[model samples]
Structures are given as structure tokens and as C-alpha cells.
Target: MKTLVIIVASLFAGVVLSAPTDSTTKDSQENTYSIKVSDHGVEKEDTIIIDEEKNIEIFQTVDSDDAEVVEDFDAGLEGIIPRNGDSCYVKPLNSGENIPPAELKSRLESSGSENVIQEQGDKDDDLYVLAGGPIKNRAVVGETIAEKCEGRNIYWLTLAEDGHQDQGRVKRSCYLYYCSLRVYLGKGRYYYHCYIVRYLC
Candidate 1:
């Protein structure tokens, strides 16, 4: 069954750190969102460009030691695009109400997640897949963990390019976590990867 729905419209706006020395132009889409940058000491307005998939293109540039990195959308959270210089990643999840907790329960194993993708031979770049079942609160489950891994507190594991995340500092706590269920549909056999993240309480 297909579980992913791609939104093909412009949805957000963001600041690009240092617009390349070459040029800075506004997109045809006329939707711009503003954000307050505490560090830059200035409020910047962002331009939003919607693609065919409705995935928001937030124009933000991160300055790396080697070069300037341009990011289209928020890498950590959807709906809210990150300001330039903000260190984070946002990946859009499959959004809808059809995903039920029961379906989530059937998909995940209690002890360990499946199709674990490991980390590359580096400390910073890594990825993995986390899975778990339904939670007591259906509302929370609807947000992140969706119906794919329903019936238990939301849980997830890290998936890196090479394989499962396994290294120093980048431990299980760093990758695997429990939070309000957030769901996203991917391009292959597996449609969902549940991540239950909890910030400082």
C-alpha cells in the first residue's frame, strides 16, 4: 500500500545566510514569511517557492568553512522553516488523518527497529530508521509516529547513508528517541519511519 502523499506547492519562506557574491533574486511565487534572527541582530524576510510536490522551498544558506551551503526547505521540522545560520534539518512527513495507531503497531517490532541503516565513517553525518507502536494519546501518535508503528510510546532509530548509526557521542540516545509521533512517506518498499523526539522538559 502507498502511504506517502507529496505536496506540490510552495509553503514557506526563509533567509539565506550569505547570498552568494553572484546574485540574489526573488522567486516568482509571491509568498514570503518573516522570522526574527536573534544572533544577526536583524529581522529577515524569506521568499517561498512551491514545487510540484508542495514541498516548501525555504531559501536559506549555511556558511561552511569550505563553501556556502544552500538549503531549500527546513530539515528538522515542517510548517516552520529555519532561518539562515540555524543548525538543523527538516524532512517532510506523510501528513494526513488516515494513519491509525493500530496500523503502526503491526508494522514495528517491540525490541528493535527493522531495515537499520548504519552511519558513515564519520561523527557528524549518520542516519538510521526507528520504529515502534501506538501510544496512549492518539493525537500525539498522529503527529510523528503515525499508524505505521502504533500501540506503544513513540520510538525511532538512526539511519545513516552507510548504515545504522553506531559511534562515539552519536549514541542510541542521540538517534533513537520517543516523542509525539511524526510520520513521513518515503520512495521505496518501506513507507514510514517513526521518530518520537523529546526536547528539554
Candidate 2:
């Protein structure tokens, strides 16, 4: 089945660390996105676009009345086009989302997220499919965890990720987690990655 219905639009003037090449131009760039929903063989699609000055509003804000049906459309997407962020997005093929190994490597390197690409000898990057918020960087990730956990009166593995991070007071309290988020941009898709000092409280 095929259908389209644009029900609402809202704007989030986010910080633009950079612009998508070939997809926009100076003073006249806008990102318009459409999503489709299906129920009982019926389909509905909605689109949202906002362009004002240098900031580009891509999705509807999560606080709007339409949010209930939008699935937090703009969650964790601020400052990520390009951003002080950690994920990469790839649009899927019309038929499916499985990525060829070569194409996966090409996209990760080109997306400026090569640092997170997990390749061993000769193979596609160890990319993971998941959803998440953006992390400013490794340093901020550590500090934020420290402050938040400390505030909750939880003894944690480290203070911050920089050199100052205290090893987990209890060896068992610490864990080193790493992954590259490859978000498939289509229906119900989002992508971002992080290389942070993750620890248990």
C-alpha cells in the first residue's frame, strides 16, 4: 500500500557544526524529511521542513502537540549536522537495509566518522545498528557521568575520562564500552555513535 499525509510542522534551530555536502547550498539550504506509518494494510506518511537563515530545522520538535505520533522526532539530533557527535546515518535501499561490506566502509570514512569505524585487517567496519543521543566527546562523556552519578549518591568507576579519571574504586565497577552507531535513515530510523568512558555506578 502507498499513502502520504503531512499533518504538522515545527522548528528546532539547532547548532550546525557543518553542512551536508552536495545536499545543500549557502543561504538556500533546507532539510525536508518524510516518514510513513502503517496499520492494518493502511499507510500514512508525513513530512516536515524548516529553513531560516543559517539554521536548518529538519524534523518537528518533540514538545509539539503532534509529538505523540512523531516518536520524539528530534530527540538527540541537535548539533549533529555535522556535530560534536558520534553517529553516522545511511539511507537504505528501496528493497532492504542490509549493507554491503564495501559500501559500509565507504560511508563511514566519508561521513567523517572514521575514528569509530571498527575494522580488523580486511573487513567492513564493526558497525552497530542502534539509537542514541549525541556525545560532545570523550572528555565530556566522562565528566557528565561522574556528576550525574555522584548527584544520585552512587559510587562509580571513574570521575572523568580524561587523565584525571579515577579507576573504578572497585575494579568490578568499571566497564569499557565502544561501538559505532549506524542509523538507517528511513522509516523509524536514527543514527549516532559515541566513544566515551562508560562506567557503572
Candidate 3:
């Protein structure tokens, strides 16, 4: 009987010692986000989990088709940009000349308007104009300029014939268009229009 008791006690102690601690169990738990994407005849799904710091911990993918399309979920713009074609021709702008940075600053300063400033992105490929004036007046001018260049892309306060902006906006009270273009060149022969715009405040 004493031997049986000792054996049971040893088994219980072993179980307790092997049990996972609270911290270990919590660390094993993960927060996951899932999404299903289906287009045409292809269906794919992804399950991503993050750690305590909100960083991706595990990226699990399950696909219906046995094909190697699981990686497509992480491939952005993989199938978007054309892979082949003749390069697109971009036409010249009939209006708005490319103004130098110094010239742009000079024009803004000569306006004799207080609080006149020019802002550009880190790449310095685009510019935005801010003038201290009534909001109503600025809106009117911005609307007019936007209308005139309705189908065109603007960059650095100049107008371009082609290209697209990630964000388009005219200054609050001035006719300022802040535009940025991102071009992706691939091995395939493809034609695209690239344009930049410059607007004076």
C-alpha cells in the first residue's frame, strides 16, 4: 500500500511539473485575421496571425486549386500591370509649362500675399501651394483649375498629359494640385503615359 501511494504521488508530481505555465499557454495563443478572395474561376484564402506587438507571426494559406497560386495573395500588382504590349505614347500638354522650383517660389513671393508657401513631397517631384486667404475664394479657384484639367494628371504644380496620382487635391483656398505618380516598368513591351502638373497659388 505504501508503494502504491508513492507511485501515485510521483505520477501526480510529474504531471504537475510537465503542465504548461500560464505565460507559455498565452504565448502560444495568436490573434488571426482571415480573408477570402475569389475572382473569375480562381478561389484563394489566407489566414494571418499576429503576435502581441501586432507583427505578423504566421501566414497560413489554403487554396482550393492544387496549383501554386497560394503566393498570389502576397503578390500585389502581380497580375495588374500588363506583361506585354507596345509602349504607350504620351501626348504633350497644350497648356501649363514646367516651372522650376526657384521660379515657383518667386511667383508665390511676388504675389505679395502673406502666408504664401509651397510644399513638396520628400521626392520633390510634386508641389503644393498654400495661400492665406478666404476658404470660399480658394475653393472657387481650385474647382476651376480641377475642371480645366479634369482628365489630366497634375504634378509639382504643372500639368501632364498622362499618368495617374495616388491622391489628388487642390489647396484649401488656392488652386494647388498635389499629385504624385508611381511608374512600374516591366520586361514586357507596354505603353503608358507619364505626366506631371504644376499649379500656381
TM-scores, each model vs. reference: 0.20, 0.20, 0.18
| lDDT of model 2 at position 1 | 3
lDDT of 2 by residue, 112-134 (tens): 31111111221111211223333
Candidate 3: count of backbone clashes, pairs at least 3 residues apart or interchain: 14
Listed per model in order, the count of residue pairs whose N, CA or C atoms clash below 3 Å is 49, 3, 14
lDDT of 1 at 103: 37
lDDT (0-100) at residue 162 of candidate 2? Answer: 31
The positional error of residue 166 in candidate 1, measured at the CA in angstroms, is: 5.0
Model 2 pairs in collision: 86-193, 87-192, 87-193
Off by over 4 Å in 3: 1-24, 63-201
Give the distance in Å from residue 114's predicted Cα in candidate 3 to where it truly belongs: 46
**Winning model by lDDT:** 2
Q: Per-model C-alpha lDDT, please?
A: 0.25, 0.27, 0.23
Predicted candidate 3 versus true structure: per-residue lDDT over 15-121, tens digit per residue:
00111122224434434444332222233344433333212122243321111110011111001001122111111222222222233222322333122112222
Tens-digit lDDT track of model 1 for 46-86:
22222212223232221111111112222222321222222
